[model samples]
Target: MDSHTKSKDSAVCHEICQSHKNKVIKFFCTNHEFLGCKDCIALNHRKCQIDHIEDKCAGIGDSEEYKTTLIELEQKIKAVDAVIKKATLQDKEVDSTYDHVIKEIVKFRKEINDRLDQLQKQILADAEKKKPEDKETVKKVLERCTDLSSDIKNFKSKLQENKTSQQDGQLYIMIKQAKSKLNMDDLKNAEECLEQTDTLCTFERNKELENILTTHNAFGMLKPFATPMTPGKKSVSVKLTDKGEINIKTQSDRNGCQITDCAELSSTKLLLADYNNCKLKVVDTQIKAVVEEKALNSAPWCIAVLPEDKIAVTVPDKKKILVMAIAGKFSIIRRIPVKGDCRGITYRQDHLYVLCLGSKCVLTVDTHGKVKNIISLKNEIFVNPYYVLLSEDARYFYISNQGSESVVVVTLQGDISAVYKHKDLSAPLGMMMLDDGSLLVCCYCNNTIHHTSGDLNEGQTILDSGLQNPWAIYYNHQDQEVYIGGYCNQLKIRKVASTV
Candidate 1:
């Protein structure tokens, strides 16, 4: 049955107006959206624009709202189905993951047992290696002592016989001979060996292994995620006081450090893109030193740490995204090839929004680097196209240019929002947004960082010194520090004082 027919039959006063039980709800007030009898309309909806129900339903199927409803219904179904499919895939992944880990655990246990067995065998082999030598030394001493006892017994018998025979000359001669033939060297060797105690072999367990086994909670450790591309909503108007500078320069750097970008691996560790050096370096922020470095096939322009141990580096010359695994060390796990030379890159909702410097456009790509869509800036006075970042709501994003005074605000459809220009925004390299709706941008050539209102309309320089040609920037809210780096300058970390 139709909804209207059901509505009339379902209630005690179904089609009848609640305000006037004797009259049916035949009119719909366009202004107030009310249904009432003639007397009720005169009292309550006299000023409202009224439309008859029949007239309102005349072209319902052809109406825009009806079309929108159809589209929304299909979209909602697809959205719900996508969620269900993802959840189901995740469920299957969980089962497979358990199976894989169990196998690894079994394999690891066997490896541990094998290593322990090898160690045990080595200890036994070492003990046995010296056992025979030591045993022989003691046995030789025992054999000499037994021979000496026999000589003593034979001499006593001879001496007793000589004394009983009353032959003084013979007895004296025998005693002299016995003293001369005593074999003192043999007796001394036995006595010296018996004088000292033998040492027993011992095994000292590995302290490090013992500590790890006793103190650790899991075979593979679990850690919270690293600092994202853009962290929580932090104000750009923060005081960057002198903390210290992390010299990203290393012994292998052939040219001046052109740190195009840097990422925080954790609170204490950082990852830097050495453009001129053609290397990626892992820095120990506490020591202000580079702890690990990985050479790249091409100069790396940007670094983006993605979900679950993955990091992406944009190699513009190579025209590919070097997908790396960031664990204790950086390893090139895979490479995602793009159509054009790529520079600036950011990740959101499992897609990489990359700014292609040569093409002068932004490509929305999957984690695999397959181009899903492109946001072109070929028409605008697009300049450097160094970095692109999505807004907090992901509705729109901003792109920076090194040669232009204005920053480009773009929707997902590639439509321009505004091209606000300012002197302080000169050579803007990297851009970030603050929680208070302020945008933080790095002025590369100006050697400064600027903060503007969320709309990029009003702004001023907050930091203007100690950073030379600042190319990349990061504001860590948890540590209350601002990290800025650039050409000819080591990455500097400054303490963030406040929202002021």
Candidate 2:
């Protein structure tokens, strides 16, 4: 239904007014939006003065409540008006750009059409100019000669009876006259004319069209749509300040650099390798809870958590990988002795990929500890071979090589794909790829986390505030945060900014 009709039918109350003052008259009450008699006014509003109702109504045209409401509405309207004004200015710019592009498009189209018309007109004009030429007359003569020759041939055959010899001679004479009148040269010219009329030549339309479309940008959207002018959500941006007091400082027993592997098992617990102690210490991040200190027969270099919460440790010094249940029972699952030491390790899809430091190779081993593939990086130009990261699709692999001073991208076939070089990065250790396809690299020597886009350029120091020798980087898409570990005041949890 129409808005006016609907509003009137709804009969929502929006005003107030006195009935009347004593007088023998009737008047319309605009505030109350109803009619009242003089007696009714006295009975309902005895003390209220109602003289010249229209004037009184006009004096208090708008109520205080209404005035306040109107002021608020006016403010709202002004806000919208400002937005519209800005949008109108932007629209004018878009329209101007659109008009410029459209003019080029129209000009191009006209030029193309004009060229096509010229071709058509030229063809028609050429054909019309040749219409009254001697070609037609020569064609008629040829047809006549052929007809007379056919008659002569029939008459000659009849002459074998001897009675039709004179008729045959007359027909032969006619045929000879016709043959002398025939022009073989003109017939050849006629054949050329037929070719000119019937043969189809190349138009070069594509090339001509390309020339007509001089402005390349003219083909795109006339007026690119302005992004919707909506308010964005307010987000909290936290930066680590040197002013805030450090609440916690915790350390693990490194056993004089004998063991170099540590990871946060959970939010509260930290798992560390103590080589001299011949044990793996699980300490608490919050409290002094020595959760578990399991003794091992050999030194453990790296550790991984299996699906069943079992811990898998790789021992390069012992040349063996051990699997221990969470209940603290250790067993030698698969022993893949390597020529070099194992540096970094990760388990995915029932396969363990370990970075062999000295050999410059990544060893992919099955759960049974059998070496499935040895991705040789021996010949690679940059072969520090510290950490390896497989993309979510497991198609592209990124390797952080300490010796090469750059990260190398390798294919699944162990071929050197692309090398990302950054000189500021000294001994790159941890590599993490964000969901937005950006790479976050933690440089150990520099103690800085470099944020780079897909091309690895335009890097910004996203977290140079408090990191001290950050050794590893891990992204948790579930929490939309990145966790940095190793040689920092504490594990730094950073929320990635929304790309949208």
Candidate 3:
């Protein structure tokens, strides 16, 4: 027998289970499609109902089911042979089709080349016809310059002769005449003649040709087709209430200071960074009192709440980030030295994202102050990235650019994705991402808080009236409240809710 036939018969006679060691598959588990010896059946298929392999294969060879399978196999083989024959014919026809398409493409290319050459010749001819006229205009201006030089020289010679002859009246008359001839207005006119106008020819695109080349139907009727999108769930409407302002009472040492940054510790507690006073104070939101106060070495510009009762603060001028442990009181854990001045800071997982002002980049560092990555923005997107807020998924980051008066969204890899700017969002300073994939932006110059989508593209005025230089914002998910802090001594709290 041939090797192929022998190999097929050997495979059919071989045992399915190698673990059985040539012990033929005597049992079959109907539910699990398992074939094994008595040992495998007891170990793994104990709970399953098994059948004898001989009983299952006894009449399969001569049964009507076997004849039906043979007929189906023959039909499939015939179908495959037909497909192979059709493919061979198609292969032969492909060469003719390719040649026909090449001929059409070459014909079209030649037509376009001839038309472009004709247009070029015509344009060159028009420019050549206008060259003499343009030259004559410049020549007249040069002649005027020569005439002005001659008149000035003649006046100088006449004045010298009068002075040599001791003719006082003539000399005076000559000087006066020269002064009148050299009037300021006339001199300015001469100077204007010296200014040259551009005479170089430039090409302007032909609108007809541009439309023929760029339109959707330029070469043929190119119809756009796309799969229709299924309707999605409707977004829930949000209801915002003006909850008025909360007067944040500071201690005697830190009284009436600008709150630059605020972070929610709990439902009724908040961490406020006293920028001007160079202090970080934890305040009780319910009673509007200071719970604890800590004095720092430098002015704290921004604060970020860390894991546990810890918090990180950015002191820009000091060029370092101070991580403090907050329990009953604030205690310094360690200071992370950075390359540039640190401004805004936020902690996620075990890493801290610090916005460096001097370098114009965001530094990602661990708790031990090891720098992992630096995300720098493109010049066009961000002139000044003041604050950085990472999305929940950590796929994108939103930055408020105070210099550009825009909020920019960038990927984690530092590529600019989108830029959001509105007339109301002037000098956007601080931002907070909401649970519903929206953002709350603090507009310092306009004294307004605007709400935007997660991408920072769509926005509208959420709070406009009772704000004064709103610099920082924080959202309390447990209490469903938003805290706004800025130049004013008071921290405003607003209740927010979502409707269907």
Candidate 4:
């Protein structure tokens, strides 16, 4: 073909060479995303790999990799479109839910108003009943005073007339009779009647209702929620296999330190609570080293990561939860005082769930440290409830009770759903629920990690050989890795193998 005809028939690249417009785009920089002529490539992209457009396009359309990439992109687009559709429907449901809640609130308000009206009416009726008797008492006292005043006036007139016209004996007899009729004690008693009826009845508020309004400061709480983005099930079966372990030792530790809790902060960084060292350490998994450590006032038992680089650590001995801001180091932003010894803690949405070791219950509190509710398993007494974990759906929580030697599944409202116990599983400590409705629990006394279904029934031992006393276990969904910490000095990470 002629040169001009060949150039016309060739795929005319949209990316024009600014420096050489006459030299149509001939080469592409593989290093940087740009199409240029030979001169442009030599000038601006000298270090970049330059390839001719014809050679770069050779067999690309027919290649399996290219075709697969195209198919994957198309599938992703469809998935995103499906998500958009689901989200739109969820938005409509949100509106419906809002309307329903508003109606329910209105109904509740009306009920409260009616009850208050009834209380007011009852109080008014009681006050009304006292009014008639109070009026009668006042009327009788006034009548007695009027009659006594008339008798006194008559007696005084007779004495005055007798003094002028009668003998002294007659006057003296009249004076004695007048004195007998006028009793001073009766007059004094009548004057006291006004004080008795002054405040016969008054309205007083119900102390219990007053306390509820003042203490809680809210009539009702509305917790709004949105649908979460569900992840696709793994194509492989998730199996626990040991990757490696690192012994955690802080500067204060002459020997090794007890790692109580471990949480994945990032893809390659995990936060560890060194109980013996009384410090919180962030470890770099890739480097197998502690990047930063912060000294705490009390020994850290458990930790929950909050939003915006904040972490809540439970100090059982102190009976408080300290919220620390984690940037380069830890700074105590707030301290929440708890009545009982705080143990395992987790943050979900804007609230924190803390397992109270002393009370043997789980308490839910808001971000501002306000107690929302206390959850205790019904008909089951927990002796030493150590760790508590909310399910992925948040409909239930799994609590590991060391004293009871069982894992209790309780609903958010504190109703016991089921209790899981096994001869091999004793003294279950730390617990975590996986996305696929499975739980990984670490046994403190047994030094083993057990895998069970969401109901905490039908499970097998996953790890037991290398652990001394596994106190805490954390599963990283993004990295598909499990981190174990406990009474031992070493922290262990294992690969989560997925089976088909």
Specify the highest-lDDT model's number. 4
Worst 10 residues of 3 by lDDT: 225-234
Q: Against the true structure, what is each candidate's TM-score?
A: 0.53, 0.45, 0.52, 0.53
Indicate whether candidate 1 or candidate 2 has the larger lDDT: 1
Error of 3 at 18 (Å): 59
Clash counts for the predictions, in order = 0, 1, 0, 9
Please give, for residues 1-500, the per-residue lDDT of candidate 3 as tens digits. Answer: 69867655544434657677856667889889888888889889998989876556654778998999999999999999977864664454355345545665676778788988998899898988778877776787778778888899999999999899999999999999899888746556645654554567688988988888988766653232210111231223465687767666565555457788888787788889888778887778888777777888778988888888888888887888898888877889998898997888888767899888779888989988999889886566678788988766555678899887888866556756567888888889988866776788899988888887664546777778788899988888877888888888788888877755
Candidate 1 local lDDT, residue 238: 58
Q: Regarding TM-score, does 1 or 3 come out ahead?
A: 1
Off by over 4 Å in 2: 1-290, 295-299, 328-335, 454-458, 487-500
lDDT of 2 by residue, 1-500 (tens): 69867655444322333443343345444445545665666566555545544334432435786688889999999999987865765566456446546666787778778987997899778766566454675566667556656755665555444444556766666556555545335555555656555333334446655765676764444553212121331223223223221212324444432334555566665565555556776655455445667767777767766666566777777666676666544455546666677867777767778888788788888767788788888775756777777755444467887777787766555655457677676778877776656677888887778765544434555567566677766555665556565553344556676532
lDDT of 1 by residue, 211-281 (tens): 87887573565343211222342345655688888778899888999888878788888888888899998
Task: Give each prediction's root-mean-square deviation over alpha carbons.
Answer: 11.7, 28.5, 26.1, 20.3
Clashing pairs in model 4? 236-498, 236-499, 237-498, 237-499, 237-500, 238-497, 238-498, 238-499, 239-497
Off by over 4 Å in 4: 1-238
Candidate 2, after superposition: displacement of residue 77 in Å? Answer: 65
Candidate lDDT (C-alpha), each:
0.77, 0.61, 0.77, 0.79
Task: Record all residue pairs in model 1 with backbone atoms less than 3 Å apart, i.e. clashing.
Answer: none
